[model samples]
Target: MKSHSEMKEIATRLKRDIIQLTSANTGHPGGAIGAAEIVAELYFNRLKHDPSNPFWEDRDRFILSNGHICTVLYSAMARSGYFEVEELKTFRKVNSRLQGHPSRHDLPGIETASGPLGQGLSIANGIALSNKLRNNNSKVYCLVGDGELQEGQIWEAAMTSAHYQLDNLVLIINWNDIQIDGHVKDVMNIEPIADKFKSFGWNTIEIDGHNISEIQSALDTFEINNGSPTAIIARTVLGNGVSYMEHEAIWHGKAPSSEEAKQALEEIGTSTFESDLIY
Candidate 1:
């Protein structure tokens, strides 16, 4: 397990990579930036995964339900040895495995091909249930955007998880208020998030998503909890590490220009991880 500081540095590097990758091509960056810490803790510290052996049978499954923010996921995957970090430059490039959204067929570590809103949880449910049937003790971690809650399919999956008592599944809600259209509340209020999860018979926990320790503790709690699935409501700022982008709905799907990315990287500071590219 990595120390909290090391994990934090990894998140910082992830934020930097997110900016560089998306700025090179059009892609969503806000939610990806906001969830950097969560992704860091999971890929670098918490998840039971082996990049060398992508199809490890008992490895934990991480489903990016709101796949639009996959820039962070891609960064984490490459940094974690799922692929060469150098390949990151090819993001959204023609015939590159890294598409605008994650594709399980294209990427080695990706658990599923995700893009359309509100389908990830259901996919996770199927995987979790399959694990249960096989008596597999591996956990399933699903990350969903708060804005994706507007989809009726998400709720249906929520009910299914609770009803089936998928204790091995962990659901993380990236509760950053801003979506592509605007603030989530302005688009469609999904407030009282934790309460709603609790009502669905889930064991819910709320925490500051940017806090590495809080993220670690929440995952720890999920591991210990039995008889119900866990839902972590991680409150976060959209575009967390970038001043101009933070909490601004406009940055949700907007790629930073070369100038904007330069500024964002300056604000993010130097990363512990070495980058192949200077920018």
Candidate 2:
């Protein structure tokens, strides 16, 4: 496992990979860029699994519920050695294992195939229940998008998780304000989100998603034996690390041009990921 500083540097570099891969203009980058730190922390220092043995039983399961931002997961998985990092450029391309949305068939580390919103929590809840029934110590970690909370299925899943008392279920919400259409508040407000989760009987926690220490601290805090599901609302900036893209909804599904990618990489303090292909 790498140190926190090392993990953060990887995250910065991962953002460069995400941008470079999505330069073909077919992948989502805004939320993926924002959730870099959270994913990096989990892959580097937290997750209990061996990259050499991706299917080892008793391994913790990470379910990416908001699948549109798969760039974050794929890049993190590559860095974690699930696959080669250079394959990132094949994103959204033909015969690419790193699909636009994650497919369980493509990656050994991916636990579920997800694309339509509001279903990841349900899948995580079921996996948590199964683990508990089997007396397995492995945990089920689910990453949800704040915009996805507007879906009714998520609330249903929340109720089921609370009722089941799935203490091993940990949910992390990427609470970036912008989504595909516009600001989440303007589209369909899910305000008082933390409070909503609390009312649903979850161990709700909030943190600055970009701060690796705080994210690690929050995960450590929830590492205790609590008899309820945990939810971490990660407040983050959309399109983080790029000046022109930060907090912009338009960048949600857009890719950067060579010039824009160069500027983005320069602003993020790294240019080693430089690429030239536009297609």
Top candidate on lDDT is 1
The stretch of ten residues in a row with the least summed lDDT in candidate 2 is 270-279
Q: What is residue 29's positional error in candidate 2, in angstroms?
A: 0.8
Q: 1-279, model 1: which lDDT tens digit per residue?
A: 898888888899999999998898889999999999999999998899999999999899999988899999999998999998888889999999998898888888999988899999999999999999999989999999999999999999999999999999999999999888888999999988988999999999999999998999999999994899999999999998789998999998999999999999999888776563553
TM-scores of the models, in the order given: 0.98, 0.95
Q: What does candidate 1 score on TM?
A: 0.98
**Model 2 per-residue lDDT tens digits across residues 1-279:** 677668768788778877877776468888899999999888888889888899998899899999999988988887778887677778888898887899998878889999899999999999998999999989888999999999999999999999999889899999998988999999999999999999999998899999998899889878896799999999999889899999899998898888988888788765332332233
Q: After superposition, how far is residue 176 of candidate 1 from its true place, in Å?
A: 0.8
Best by TM-score: 1
Clashing pairs in 1: none
lDDT of all predictions: 0.91, 0.87
User: Any runs in candidate 1 off by more than 4 Å, and if so which?
Assistant: 276-279
Candidate 1 residue 13 Cα shift, in angstroms, is 0.5
